[model samples]
Target chain A: MLDSKQMITIKGTKDGLTLFIDDHSSFEAILDELSDKLSEYKPKKDEPVVPVTVKLGDRYLNDRQKKQLNELISAKNCFTIHAFDSNVVHRDEALTWKEESEIRVVNRIVRSGQVLEYVGDLLLVGDVNPGGKVITTGNIFIMGNLLGIAHAGVNGDRDAVIAASYMKPNQLRIADYISRAPDYDSEGVYMECGLIDKEQDKIVIDRLQVLSRKRKDISGFERRMLNG
Target chain B: MGEAIVITSGKGGVGKTTTTANIGTALALMEKKVCLIDTDIGLRNLDVIMGLENRIIYDIVDVIEQRCKLKQALIKDKRFDYLSLLPAAQTSDKAAVTKDGMETIVSELKQEYDYIIIDCPAGIEQGFQNAVTGADKAIVITTPEKSSVRDADRIVGLLENESIDPPKLVINRIRNHMMKNGDMLDIDDIIQILSIDLIGIVVDDDEVIKASNNGEPIALQGNSKASIAYRNIARRMLGETVPLQSLEDEKGMFYKVKKFFGMRT
Candidate 1:
């Protein structure tokens, strides 16, 4: 009989307790060991409920397995699940992430009553006239003037941003929040960027330089330039 | 075959009928056979503008419904021997003329006329669609106002989806002093938004209204600034390179004295 303690290990950290499961064991064996070990363990008297993080190293767990593991952890009265950490992700999830990070380049004017929509980030090379709209699930970057409507982070990604050379849009939306241009004429001579201010829960326009600090992972070339 | 051009402005009261009348008359003055088709059906105005409302024995609907021959529906202009007007029906609605009916009528007119100018009604509904269906080319007219320019942009966008040639722009009703004082939108600004080839610019003149009221197109007068502008537009349509007419007012002797004294007028 192999030692059961080698399949699962627990360590105390500043935040809470971390449970590491061995990838070499079969999923059924891991489940059996987890249930046996958690049930046999006794909590110290008056010891408050400790948050636990389960780290699955190189292990893939589908929804059903994850649910079973979560149920087993919850049955233990002394511990609460803080998070689930995994080294591997499903192909579909990785594909969605890759798509969200990609930038699509388009070169055409978006005229009035026209709509240009994209799944990922959009990089438009021409102007967006009044009554025109550009919608995207990710960020939007316009090389020409933006005198129309722009909706970024359309899929509820609050971190998405909108940047334009001449940002005089009629209306701007980031995630679920909507904002309109001020009544006074604000003809921006320089490029500008718009993002959601989480503190105020409002869409705020800022200088283009703010994008560099906010979106550090936007482009590898920019990062290389900064590092050099 | 004649080139069919639809003169359209998405908004109402921006001088669409007047433009159609003047362009048709100007082409006639150039000695070219021109036919003007009014597509505003229930709200017909092109005939009134051309001063031919009394001679309407048959209308476009009658010709389309085969109630009369095409020649019988054409009302000859009193001033121009080569110009004719096909009035819209005041009794029927815009839906009375289908797209196929319009195409047939315009194609028949094209075989005889040198230029067929269609005066499209306002808005992007059936009337606008019926007007543009038979045309080979489009001309979008707009004033310097924000609303007019925005609507013109929408019309230009819609026209792009059609098989016709790229639509040209005409900025109508430009006031010189207001433009100079930065009160109205500049010509450059309107062009920037619409982003289409500009065919011509028409200066706002009271003479246009007066000529329309008298049932005579301003282009036939050959004296007013509006008349000259319309003539230039017509010449441009005939493939002539006509320079844009200056919008500056004629300087008087008092204005010249002010310039000599280095004083603002």
Candidate 2:
């Protein structure tokens, strides 16, 4: 029978702990093993920091998927993850976490003088009137007209986009960049979206089909610093 | 117990007082005992609109302060046998009206009347709060303007938080031609914004102005199309399903000519 340590190894280093998760097993199974092993494996009694180095041994994960694994490690509240390493090549298809995100739906016209705020992707079935505002940390999906102010990537995520059926918006903001409606596109051509472009310099408004590709590239995983 | 229905339009001058007088008189005409309370306090208007201003001897302040009995404070409207008016104090401010006092008065009135229609004051301050204190339901009035719709939306949020049921919307002063021309907000636009059950839709008519100036509610007159609309609203409030009259009746010059020629539309 294989030993538990061989399946998922944990070693002590001068600075922190080094965790090696076996690649043969599924990520879920690996996570279960890691969680179980980490919870049971306590460090030296007086250790101040719980710095950890995770080696996936040739597995591919985008920033978001890596962030998920990092979150699981942080949930233990015993370690500070320094690095997430895998030898496998990062593929566009390997991006995960979009499936895990919450998509909030509201079926009401966001009227003037009203403010609608959400953390997840907001799907509104109504129009945003001229003095109304919609804000979200994730993407904004409006089934009705976007005639008001909409701010996406409120958490400084350049990837977040605002998509609407009628995109004749008064103002739009993506991450830190802000732009007003141009006179020519006073009435937007078709179903459109506003997103931060490749240069990360400004927000670009385009047909939704062309814009959604940028969304699929990043998915919905957010990466943040892990606290011990 | 009688239900307290507050007629409120968050912004000023959208016809909350006028609607109250009409609905109260209409309800009374239907043989239902109804009382109209001018909870506007210092800024009283219900008494004037109901033409019961001269009959107000003991006002709401006097009843609250024990200077007069609740019965004495109520002015019986001679126009309708079952209709009465609780006039607001011409002198005292909204601070004189307490939630507990209003609640007591409403509970007492509930014993004798079928409906208590409160004419809420403009703005969401003490006057508005005092009017809404004992309301069982709400009727939010709004003009088809951006500001009116905005204020109505805020009031709807407040009512959903405080009132028993989601407040019913009454879109007043809608201009059909402007709506068709895409110049003004329509009933659907206002409803879409407020997202509340629409109780009534009142079109802009000269009759409403004449009715108010004459101290008569259009509903009680039973003459003009506006009066019929108001009566239908009252009937609907009594739990009767009245189909809304569509605005497509007069489309353009061609339709008007046909109607003028007495041809079937």
Candidate 3:
């Protein structure tokens, strides 16, 4: 007799919008609330935000609930919905609802014969075993082992990356590129993956060295990591 | 309290029913109250194996659909008072019972017996789902052959997704002499690949075929190599830690010399 409650919270970012849902709330109620808030931000002539961002709660959402959430977001023009469990991955990016999409999945173990698909970036704080698969339209990050299949940018975003703590997946795919484990024994940094270079039209993978980028003003989870 | 264990193999013709018949009879002969439920609806054989088919007036579907009471459907064993058979209905389909329905029946049977063993149907369909629905534990049976092992792996995957914890493996129809001569896979290979807890190892015994023809389970006779293996499985289900009988002892120097002379073991 354990039922979950769904709560939806909306906050305006400097660029666009941010919608957040806390753990295990009524999904139907959250959708109704989201529809009401979305109508309020239709488009003011003064607004300059590109695409909106919505953050989802970290918990098990059944297939029906997930499909319903996806349909609701897609109805809005150029909007992105991010889902994550706070208990799993602690996000740190700072922006008004106008920026990056976030999605978090906190499962104990992704069992065999179960196919888990997400439209945005996925952060898994659990293991993906032999028969299970994680398919995402954006980047995928696994805090635990990736022993099964992990496909990122499933919709053909070549820049998407698949990172995990223990990357021993049976198969790895990003965008349209695919890679299986090499026949020879090999090991490098903990996070290893298959990625594509658009300019070269070639797929290559090695150790994930830290990328250099301009540091942006950070707050919340990102700010905590920057300081630490 | 008897454990409700389901013997499931995702592939057909891999000896699940045979294993169930032997294990149930073995447990009964050990003085444990046992009821074997054939959940294969439309193709029930537990009654035939137990030689109670002629006496079967009521079946599991009758009891479940409320056409009859539980006691009326139970076929008492002639060999042992502790054993009974709940045969599946040959006319009904898998949809005749749901997972919840099976759970109710198992929970009720659990109160009256020391062990309730379910014989699951092949494939990952509704029948398989119903069989494991109310099981407290599961024993995935497989032969060392490739096709059987592949199906076993698939079943293991399904069980994990369903969150059935720590399922035990029972390797059946193993041929030790064939393994020594590089003709068959050894026990170590199967154990390493499946990566699950082992309960028993049943050897290929001619006595099993002989007993089946007579409509008597080898476990009741308690002399064939397969019967001892089934006894080990029953003990393991009872939470007894009994190591498998050494295959090496069974395949001693005499069998080795027979192999040297190019004789078929």
Candidate 4:
């Protein structure tokens, strides 16, 4: 091979110093280069402790290797670790994130005194009868009538929404805000959605069509499909 | 084996005991050997409804606690030779009876009787659980009122989780005038909300309370509308296909004549 390529490159910006480690290099070689580069590096006297961010390009690091890397960086007294940024994640962590973000579908009558709950978004295909409850951490989409209580964003996600085909629910909750149905019977002929109004700091019921504007991220796949 | 049916309403004073007494009596009139168990314990009323409170020497508690044999505690009905009442213990609380205990008692009674009707106590507590534990089928009773229908829905939900067959519904205390005036819930509305099969509907008749006060079930009467409704329910329970009685039957001949002349009653 020609001259050995640099495995570790350091750059400086307004925020702090950034170390970009070459992923194609062997781990031992990268570690040796990082040690050598850090040993020779010097900060200005006026700013002795420079915050450094380490970027591993498309490289996944296990806990032990991450610990070793942190120790090596911390050994340099002139540098402080800001964070370790990585482009790749372990399969298990990726799977958990996928699970938390995916929508869960359920088809059954949620009768009185029964509670249906999920960790992520919920899509219920049946009616939620009075005295029943449906809860989720993300969003709720009821294809049938929702006559009971529905709680979206149980873990405090304020942006979550609850949409129902017939929205005469006993109560609606989003994040920490709760609002009971009005005493008078609402004309439940049209579909409705409940969400948090940040300006008023209360839950508000709106037309279901507002969902497209309120939660634009939920329509990304549909938009892409339409574009194609 | 005889089928054990539990008559329950999640709310109080929805005529569970009355229905139990009437159905048991109607079944006995059909010549089937019937046993009625009062699971209300400290709040025993089935015996009084069946006019056998004075004859309750030994009770369900006595049978469950082994103080008396099952047959010894069963008080024979005064009207029917085959009808019997196992009154609940007036002194003991609901906690005295366990699910397994009720199961054992009901199964033991099932061996001899053609039908065992259990009167479940109100509220979803130990009393309700004990009453429902031994039943093979359930009849959830509700009125046309909102609160009663809500409670009945809860009872139906709880019953669905059990191993027994899906519970049937009986819309009791219906008022024809209130329904006509739109002041009360419609029978179709109640059935749609409860989402269960309607076995029968009993109109709001003063004769029901009068019969209960005299410790005579209305089903014993031959011509009363409430008695006919109870008999129809009993016949339906026996797998007979009896069409639901029309509310028009309660109207007078003059109302019918006015309707024939296109005049609003």
Per-candidate iRMS values, in order, are 0.8, 2.7, 3.5, 0.9
In the range A1-228, model 1's lDDT, one tens digit per residue, is: 278458889999999999999988898888888888887888889888889999999998889998888888877577888887888889987676666667889998898899999987899999999999999988899999899999998988787889998988999999999999889987754688999887888999999898778776667234322332
TM-score of chain A of each: 0.84, 0.57, 0.46, 0.74
Q: Which lDDT value does model 3 have at A216? A: 29
Residues A1-228, model 3: lDDT tens digits? 122443666677775566677666666667777777567767656543244454654655555876777677757554655442333332323332112345556655565566778766688887776656899876778877776789987877666777787777778898888877778755533775556656667555555553222112212244333332
State the DockQ of every prediction: 0.61, 0.21, 0.15, 0.67
Question: Compared with the true structure, what per-residue lDDT tens digits does model 1 show for residues B1-265?
Answer: 9999999999999989999999899999999999999999999999999999999999999998999999999999998689999999999867789999999999999999999999999999999999999899999999999999989988988998899998998889999999999999999999888888888999999999999999999998967889999999999999999999899888889999999999987
Best by DockQ: 4
Using lDDT as the measure, the top candidate is 1
Q: Candidate 1: what lDDT? A: 0.90
| Clash pairs, model 4 backbone | none
lDDT of 1 at A114: 94
The DockQ-derived docking category for candidate 1 is medium
The numbered model that scores best in TM-score is: 4
Which regions in candidate 1 have their CA more than 4 angstroms from the true location?
Answer: A1-38, A42-65, A75-91, A198-201, A220-228, B252-265
For model 2, the docking class works out as incorrect
Which residue pairs in candidate 2 have backbone atoms (N, alpha carbon, C) closer than 3 angstroms, thus clashing? Answer: A58-A87
- Badly placed stretches (over 4 Å) of model 3 are A1-109, A117-130, A137-148, A162-171, A179-192, A197-228, B99-101, B145-150, B153-165, B175-196, B204-206, B221-223, B252-265
Higher-scoring candidate on TM-score, 2 or 4: 4
* Residue range A1-228, candidate 2, lDDT tens digits: 245546577888997888887877777777777677667767676656588898889777668868878888887566779887667654433332342255778998776667999875789998887768999877898998888899987878777888898887889988888989877734464588888777857888888788545665444444311110
